[model samples]
Target: MSPEPYLGDTTRTPIRHHILSVLVENKPGVLARIAGLFARRGFNIYSLAVAPAESHARFSRVTIVVDAESAPLEQIVGQLDKLVNVVAITDLAPRDALERELLIASVPVDDDNRLTVLDTITHGGASIVDVGATSVTVMLAGTPDACDELERSLEKFSDVELHRTGRVALPRLG
Candidate 1:
């Protein structure tokens, strides 16, 4: 028999993003087990972030951005629910959630473009984090779309090194 098609095959299903906020006991190997499940099942995880959820360090919140085309949302959630450490899972729909990502970029600059680069960065609502002899580094914490636009704008500068933290989200209250 032919191998099963990749769950997120573009031709089979249109791509969509689903953000899942998972709460789990803060224990070793829990993250590894979750990642192993995705690897074994061929699910596509677009982005993931994990951090302590409480000061007591008893639980962690894992934010996962999944490729909706990879598998049925219900199926994915059901599989995650079977994990022993997973305490709860909440799907944060775009409209019902608030999401943010952090972007840091270092762009080469010179006498001719330093002012212009600063202008662009400030105008984009990013703050200058560092200034070196030949480059300037900027930081922006914003919605994914805003970060995308800023990244595109920086492409005009050659040798720009950009890093972005994957999205972290929470459901909106009220």
Candidate 2:
């Protein structure tokens, strides 16, 4: 018998291509249970973000990115909906959606590289959100690959940090 395919990508290409949005009641243990389920199921959640909702709803919007084919992804989606606290499950990547982005990076800079660093920021649609004598943290919002591009462009200057909010789309009408 052959071993099962690994998570994320079977070969080099990521198999599960999905961005799942889960609405859940904000309370202790709820998040853990949900996460535990994924862990046990061997889902490679590449990215996830959770925060409370507005209107005192005490709900959290969890964006999950996973790699698998359609049929497998459907099973995962169905199982996710069965969880007790899950309120809604939306495939935001297929549909359109809105997302919030937060970034925190610590970058080292010296006189020799400061200009280069500044140039990278300008090109990345980001600015220095925080500054210190030897380091700076640049912040930006957009696609994950955009942020990766910025990091790649600046790789020569010094060490860098990157965080991606992943790709999110909302219906054009909205």
Candidate 3:
């Protein structure tokens, strides 16, 4: 379904985030064009993930989480629609979409905090992927909120490195 045109509606409050599942031709420079379009229009993207769609490599799906507060949702979609490579754009409201994110962190551990770190990791539903003499690497694949919580819990470590794969989502089927 297309989004309602947001023409300066002061009475209505805008949603903070809007996920756009964009289908595009699998070709070089398509991403560049899309990024350039957002840059030109000054729309802020919160998270973006792209991958080949279905069994064929002829098309790719781009899941873009846009900051709705940054620009009018209608204009963002309109600019994206103007691109020739873009096949289709589906705006998925947070409730209508199922989203997931992956976060990997390598946190330092000493005798003092090793047990506490492991406890935090297990409590957060994260798996210990790798263990070392000085650190442990944990992987968490879950909802965005869960990942954020796990990250926050790990911040007590002095040396922790985190890498997150920005959100990827699909429309929920009734």
Ranking by lDDT: 3, 1, 2
Two-way lDDT contest, 1 vs 3, winner: 3
lDDT of 2 by residue, 1-174 (tens): 212111121122233456787889998898887889888887767677776755656788777776655347877888889898999887855324343344446779888878877877777666677898889987766445445556577667646766666544333355
Off by over 4 Å in 3: 1-14
lDDT of each: 0.81, 0.65, 0.85
TM-score of 2: 0.78
* Cα error of candidate 3 at position 89, Å: 0.7
| Best candidate (score: lDDT) | 3
Off by over 4 Å in 2: 1-15, 94-100, 163-174
Which 10 consecutive positions of candidate 2 have the poorest summed lDDT? 1-10
Model 1 weakest lDDT span, ten residues long: 4-13
Q: How many backbone clashes does candidate 3 have?
A: 0
Which candidate leads in TM-score?
A: 3
Ranking by TM-score: 3, 1, 2
Worst 10 residues of 3 by lDDT: 2-11
TM for every model, in the order presented, reads 0.87, 0.78, 0.89
Clash statistics: count for each candidate? 0, 7, 0
Residue-pair clash count for candidate 2 = 7
